[model samples]
Target: MKLRRRAGLFAILAAIILAIAYGFMPKPLPVETAEVKRKYMRVAIEEEGRTRIIDRFIISAPVAGFARRIELDAGDPVSKGEAITELEPLRSNVLDPRSRAEAKARVAAAEASLRAVKENVHAAKASAEFAKKELDRLRQLFKDALVAQEKLDEAETETRRTAAALRSSEFAVEVARHKKAAALTALKYSAAREPEEYAERVIIKAPVSGRVLRINHKSEGVVNRGQPLIEIGDPQALEVEADLLSADAVRISPGTPVLFERWGGDKLLKGRVRVVEPAGFTKISALGVEEQRVLVISDIVSPPGMWAELGDGYRVEASFILWENDNVLQIPASALFRYGDGWAVFVFSNERARMRKVQIGYRNGLSAQILSGLAAGDKVITHPDSSIKEGARVRLRKERTL
Candidate 1:
């Protein structure tokens, strides 16, 4: 009986020790996981874009004058050749002392030039009269058989040449007079003498039939020639401009499909790449990073009434399709980790973590293409950490969904 009790006690002590050892062993790590699956996958580049009129026109003041108050606002319909605004000559622009002096000198020079031209005209006229008389005399001599026909022809040619010279001198005088007038106008002397006379209304007309987009001048004011007055464009003819990173733009080509969204409409609009500008510009990102960007122009291919409410400068999101497949083996991008020069994933099998080297093709922010080293229905440990090691025992925190 003593031997039996001793044996039973020893067996109980051994069982207790074994139980303590088992309790001290490291417990399986609990991890969140996802199942790899075959699904439709696509790789695309997305960026914010804006709508713009393809044929925008800016109307500028045709002449420097007093621009009347523009009653027309943006979006106002305008017809081709229809007057949009009137500019009446205001008291000529104020001239500085130096400018006034220069104007006076120019005016005097022009008057002197005009007098010289007038004298030249008189001299040409006198020569022409002398030539005509000589020609008549020669013709009379030729008729009497005293002078040769060649001499008569020479006299007639001289008369014609002198007449042309007189006409040229007269034109020069007119040009000089115009110069004098311009000089006087520049000095503002004409305005000072006949202010009301300079108030003749000059009408400005629309160059094309379209709606006004912008107005630079609204109130009556003086404007210089070539100053912008309004912008006009056909709202129906619209395109989209997207600035993309230079790296992404290189992959885009003309005629690539595009999807436009978040443009204040429930339905998505369609567009196609028209051009990838050959040049790039430097842009500062919101995070203060300098980025090289290229312009990607896209034509709105959707029919009217679909995005009828869309207008110039409206913001939209654009997605440029790069590559896509209807069915592809894909895994969460988070499942991938850098391994050597390639990529790897922590695959879950037999309730343990297995290091896997994977060949990846394309990847976006959310998912990645699995070209090899993984199969459909395989479970991967998402967000793997240092605690996960080769052959490390793992327990699912919850059932992983495909």
Candidate 2:
């Protein structure tokens, strides 16, 4: 009986100690996991952009007058040289005698001014020609070491100045002719003894074959000279304009492939970068952050009919493909965590969480390319937290398996 009691007590004591040890031991951690995949991967930049006509034209009134009601509405198609609007003489309830005299005097003054401008244009042309020749001669002399750099620079500067002056003089000639025409029209209208109904109407025609984008004035009203009347452009010649961060803009160059989506179409549009403007502009983002942005123009390489539903100012999401590969070993970006000086992931090995340091190549918002320390079909824990550590026992929910 004594031996039986001792054996029974020892067995009970062993049971209690075993239960205590088991209770203090770390429990299995339930975790979500995903398999490392070997698949195609791409690193890209996404930004919202607007569609615009590549060659937009804004037609304006040539002279101040009473504009007749525009018969066209926005989106109305017209051919080149089609009359889209008319301009009639400004309705005048009274004609002043002094105004008539002033009109005649203005015509004479305008003629004198036009002649002087013509003479100036001729002088500017001669000066420009001389500057070009001087620049060419100085360039040759510079190459032979016969002229100093300063002299060469001065000659080049003078050439540019003369060219600019020549252009300005030519533009001035157009302005002077317009003024002369205005003065003559004023004189002719002032000579009318009664209301200016005798004045002829001027027809405004479409400068290009395109659909009207918008009308500045749909109803008849008084208009100023050079006031924009209508905007016109071909809807078929559409390009996307995206303002990208200057930092991102530098990474992309002309001919970069792009994919456009969410543009209210079932078709995925393909395009290529055409130009990255040399200049940058400041824009405030929706988060109130000031960002320096550059305008990136992209050409729609897809058939125009695919994006026929798209129009000016339409919004599109542009994905610029910076890097891509067909066969890449990648894992979810969330599976990675900072470990020491490098990045690491929790690999599920034999029902235990194993710390793995990995060399990563390119990472975007979702996936990361694994350059080393991992292989295909490896399962990695996602959203790892404090509960996970080296050699810790882990459980894979039934939905996930290695």
Candidate 3:
């Protein structure tokens, strides 16, 4: 009985030691894993953009006048040469105390200027007449051999100069007369104390057959000549304007393929690079960072029927395909971690995390191209943490497919 009890106690101690050893063993780290892909890989640059008409037309006031109230609004369709608005002559100011004094002073000043110019004209005519008589006398004396040829030439030159001065003075008198007339008219209209009546209005027409995109003035008001009144454009012919970082714009060339999205459309719109503007501008980002940005114009290659909803200044997101290839090895960007000067990933092999150094090529926001040190169908830990180590035992919590 004693021998059997001793053997049972020894067995119990061995069982306890085995249980402790099992408890101390490390458990496999549960992690998310993804497979290396052998499909096509595309690296693109994406930025927010806005849609605009490829050709926009702005109509401005043809003359300085009082613009009539606009009956049309933005988005209203218009035809070429159709009258959009009318401009009437501006009304004279009401004859208030200060305004009446100013008008009277202007009239008096213009009358004085007209008198001065008329006197100058009379004096110039007198001078010209005296020069002509002197020239005739000089010519007669030269013919009688009494005056030198140089004296006769001098007299003729004086006559010609005086004639030109007379003509200039006459023109000045005409200008002064017009000024006086304008001043008198202004004073008379102000003193009439009656509301102005419009006898004629200049009609402004649309230059293009399209919808009005914007209107600078809506109500009747005095407007100057060449003041922009409305903007018109064809919404069907659309182009996208995207501002990209200066560095990225340099790599883009005309004819690059582009994909447009988030333009209130169900499907993506297609476009191609039409131009990369040569100039760059400074723009402030939301994070308060100053960046050099360039405008990249992209023509919508999609048919008009596909993006009919797009209009001028509509918001969109554009992705420029910088590089792409079919049958290239790639992996999820999350599977990568910085290892030395290159990159590394915890490749899942034989139920363990095997540290593998990788050579990376093109990388976008979501995925990266694997140039070397990895193969298709290999599993790598995604979002690996500090708990994960080289040669650590691991188990797949979930499998991610690209």
- RMSD to the true structure for each prediction, in A, is 8.4, 21.9, 8.3
- Which residue window of length 10 is worst by lDDT in model 3? 186-195
lDDT of 1: 0.90
For all candidates in order, the CA lDDT equals 0.90, 0.91, 0.92
Q: Higher TM-score: candidate 1 or 2? A: 2
Quick one: ranking by lDDT, best first?
3, 2, 1
- Better structure of 2 and 3 per lDDT: 3
Can you write out model 3's per-residue Cα lDDT over 142-186, one digit (the tens) per residue? 999999999999999999999999999999999998998888886
Q: Ten-residue segment with the worst summed lDDT in candidate 2?
A: 189-198
Residues 1-402 of candidate 1 have per-residue lDDT tens digits of 999999999999999999999999979999889989998888889999999999998888888988989989899999999888898876555677887788889989989988999999999999989999999899889999999878988999999999999899889989989988987778665344555544478888989999999999989988999999889899999999999999999999999999998999999898999999999999999999999999999998988789999999999999998888979999999889999999999988999999999999988778999999999989999989989999999999975564
Please give, for residues 35-144, the per-residue lDDT of candidate 2 as tens digits. 99888889999999999998999989999988988989899999999998899877753348887788789988888988888898999999999999999999999999
lDDT of 3 at 71: 91
Q: What's model 2's lDDT at 161?
A: 95
